[model samples]
Target: MDARFLGIPELVEVPDVAVVVDVMRAFTVAAWAFAQGAERIVLAGSPDEALALKARHPGAVALKDGAPAPGFDAVNSPGRLRSVDLGGRTVVQKTTAGTVGALAVKEASLVLCAGFVVAEATARLLRTRGCDGVTFVVTGEDGQADEDLACAQYIARRAAGTETDPAGYLHRAGASRAAAELTQGVRQGVHPDDVALCLELDRFPFALVAAVEEGLMVLRPHAVPSPIEGPSPIDGRPL
Candidate 1:
């Protein structure tokens, strides 16, 4: 399998498989939510979309702009959700990077959201599926970020069956300016612990595989090979 990394949301020709990376918080939060028993996560590309989804499913947890939307359960903060009960619930997350990147590639055969939490599982799955061409989309707000880049690099290398040193990438991720700035975004109610959670590598063993149905992006938890149920349908509700 051949893999390439692309920045921003451009689709000159979307690849056969796209792995969207948003290590700062969005995808990472979704991973944790799934681990804590959330059934599925809907990746709404904008705040208004998330709000509209909430209007339909009033009990869904809505996260917008890295903060909890008013009347929502929690923001895009893994730490905040650490103690919250998410079993059998649907999460509507609208982020500046993660969801935007996932939504941009409308033509990809497969779309999976990633962070350090699901890096290894994602790589293994890609190899198992025998993906011919893979594009790692880094949804960096400023066009690039260490957290996103590191996660992409890890997956790209692992998919190619190459040895990877995660320590260096993890270090870069924790030391990136984005990590520092987001930690201080306490002004936006972002706690420092949330930044730490984003940097925790390989915290989970499953990836969030997505599918577009009726123009909406929906994600379901995916694991390696036999246990995997392929991707979610656009209109399929979370499990």
Candidate 2:
């Protein structure tokens, strides 16, 4: 069966395998956490729940996000996650949309957390694994589709053995580049550096697959370092 497409917010009712994208940050940060050596990630549905989970996990890093607080660990920046020491530790995260969307898709046969940072490898995985009819859920902002739809369409095209076409994805119904642009525009207003960070393709060789049974997320690194993470970069030095 071929995979179908659905907007991220609509996933609350669907019953199919899902690929969750929050490319601007949430899933990107989650992938970064894994790259930074996090053992597992507990994606919370709300900020309050994340705080509660933090209290329960003791010593586990917690990120509570409620209406854009500046002091708290905002779970929206991949750059922030890069600096943290997640080595063998758990991270409890809440975000404006991504984490909640992941929870919504928890009932799927497989819920994969994805981002444009790992786009190519993720698409390759689907083809290699023969994933059919997977749904691309772009965890949109305020019921509007986010830039995640670009990532989703990129994956879908790859799965269908088609070439990359950003416009094709952006122009489709329920896949609004305008919504994505608005979200990215907001990010630009607050932190332009992050906008660039989120656009870099295939920086991490790993894919963070949602491990529902264990109530955690798992990272699977591709066999080779992504071109972005060239030998010089991984050779204990900058590339």
For all candidates in order, the CA lDDT equals 0.78, 0.64
- Single out the weakest 10-residue window by summed lDDT for candidate 2: 230-239
Residues 1-239 of candidate 1 have per-residue lDDT tens digits of 77788886455676778999999888988888887778778878677778888777757877766444565567777777787888888888887778888888756888888999888878887887788789889888544787898889888998888998889888988888778887667336476687778877778767789887666688888755324455433223331
Itemize residue pairs with steric clashes in candidate 2. Answer: 2-133, 3-133, 3-134
Error of 2 at 184 (Å): 9.0
TM-score of each: 0.88, 0.76
Cα lDDT for residue 197, model 1?
A: 87
Model 1 ranges with Cα > 4 A deviation: 225-239
Error of 2 at 199 (Å): 0.5
Report the CA-based lDDT of candidate 1 relative to the real structure: 0.78
CA lDDT, candidate 2, residue 147: 69
Q: Model 1 reaches what TM-score against the true structure?
A: 0.88
After TM-score superposition, what is the CA distance of residue 11 in candidate 2 from its true location, in Å? 3.1
Task: Residues 75-154, candidate 2: write the lDDT tens digits.
Answer: 55665567777777778877777777777777777677787777776776677567877877777664355567677878
